[model samples]
Target: MSRSLVIAPQWIGDAVMTQPLLRRLHARGERLTVGAVPWVAPVYRAMPQVEQVLEFPFQHGGLQWGARRRLGRELHGRFDTAYVLPNSLKSALLPFLASIPRRVGYLGEARVGLLTHRLKNPQDKPPMVAFYSALSGEREGLEQDRPVLRLDAREIDAALAAQGLRRGGYLVFAPGAEYGSSKRWPVEHYAALAASLQQPVLLLGSGKDTPVCEAIAAAAPNCRNLAGHTSLAQAFALIAAARAVVSNDSGLMHVAAAFGVPQVALFGSSSPLHTPPLNDAARVVWLKDDPGYQPPLDCAPCFARECPLGHHRCLRDVRPERVAGLVQGAVSSA
Candidate 1:
């Protein structure tokens, strides 16, 4: 029996994208374990591939050293191989400390010595999910084109009942991104889209996004703010039940893809080429730079927390009608 461990990515979107790899590993019938942050543990709790879900105290930077040591001690001599999905120097430290013989990960940050099987990162990756799926199999060819996420039917039913979602149709709007304001679509644009939807809209986000959700809900009479009320699992459950999801490029967009829900994703400052949603039922809308309409002096897509130029035109220029049209088309086609 080949005993294996996978260190899951911290972001919800990345976690969802890693599901296909986990499923492939599970199908091999290996003794598999997953090391993940506490918040992300629930997402994989029900995955049959995971023999155990190990939690690491992560959120705070200070606890990482101690957590790595503790995890290394607890999992020492337990797994024959460990696969790390996140491409961070710090992520490599734990499995190495745990003394796992074969640590597999992409070649990045000059961690060649740290990883036993260091796969070269793919050139011009098709999608983020596709890129991650390549890490699992030996064939080196893309194992699968579609990303898969397994959601319990009971959980879906419960979320539907709790949210008072109609049986056949509803629209979901996720208006937050953890990366930064640069990745977020304008909330008013979301409100305009919600107003145009034929079905009632359910706003999804975390506590930090409540204010934005509230503003959209207030603007659209049929919209309801469900942010900050549901757990991460519940949020996915709700998304799974919706007819279509209109979102910014965020974790929920990835969750929507996992569920195979129709989605219209708005992008600004972030490149869809690097991390496009991995669902066939999804479409991405982005702004093409116009020389005459430059709103800020800073480089757009700088991938920064706050816009370097102070004014944010990359996101602001995208109209609400454009997003609404895309969402409407997606829902109608589905």
Candidate 2:
């Protein structure tokens, strides 16, 4: 098998979307080892196609050239090819430094010469999953391929135990969106939904989400806030074991989709048409698609971190009752 190094994307959602691309490589007899920053490393562990995950020591922003060089030297002669996922110039630097015989990625951010085999950036943006899968140089089925992640049942059980959770006994409320408030459904809406549900609701996210999760937990006695308390591995196991999940268009939403857990994905300033949860079990709630939602959200999918219009009608218009109904149905059937 040809050994390959995958330079993973920095953002958690983007990292999860790359799974389909990795799968394509693994199917062709490529042994995959992923290079990821600390935060994204956990998701790669859940990918069965990946043989190893090398967590980079570099912090966010800047080149961190010396560190990259050291890691690249350590990886030298270990891989035959490198697939760089991000479009930024810095993302392609390690593979070039490592002297991997073949390096492939989309050309962008003036890193033209860094990659040995570069694909032109598509003029029109494509779904992130397809964008990454193209790095495999296989065009067929790119759009149809969905990301999948797996954890052994024992691992799932242990994670649940640590969180004081039982399999399929709780619902997950991932109310925080890393992109910004524009992508997050109203916190009050989440609390309202949890209050009406009989099942326990576990709020999960990064440290930044603690305040938001805590607020929701306070409003709903049925909700337990675990944000920033559990490792990403535990979070993954929790999503995998959830009876159903109610989440914004965030990384954990993608995680729930990958696990094939029943989910209600809320999209606001971001468009689901672009980064949708590519799972059969997911139901997307986007007001932009609802014609009856007057005056229609033409400004929707502004892709802004914050709503420019002051009123976030896109998500604000999507009532908690609607989301709660979907979750209730999902739980009943599951």
- Compute each candidate's TM-score over C-alphas: 0.88, 0.98
Clash count for candidate 1 is: 0
Error of 2 at 226 (Å): 0.2
Residues 150-220, candidate 2: write the lDDT tens digits.
99999899999887778888999999999889998888889888988767999999999999999999999
Model 1 C-alpha lDDT per residue in residues 1-334, reported as the tens digit of each score:
8899898898877887777777777777778888889878866774656778988777735537887888788889999999999888778888899999999999887788879998888765456766777777645445355456777799889988887775556888899888888888777788777777656888998999999899988888988898999998888888888888988888888888877798998777776776778777887876644455544434655667666776667787878787777776776676
Q: Which pairs in model 1 have colliding backbones? A: none
Off by over 4 Å in 2: 332-334
C-alpha displacement of 91 in model 2, angstroms? 0.9
The best candidate by TM-score is 2
Residue 23 accuracy (lDDT) in model 2: 90
C-alpha lDDT values of all predictions: 0.79, 0.91
What value of lDDT does candidate 2 attain over all alpha carbons?
0.91
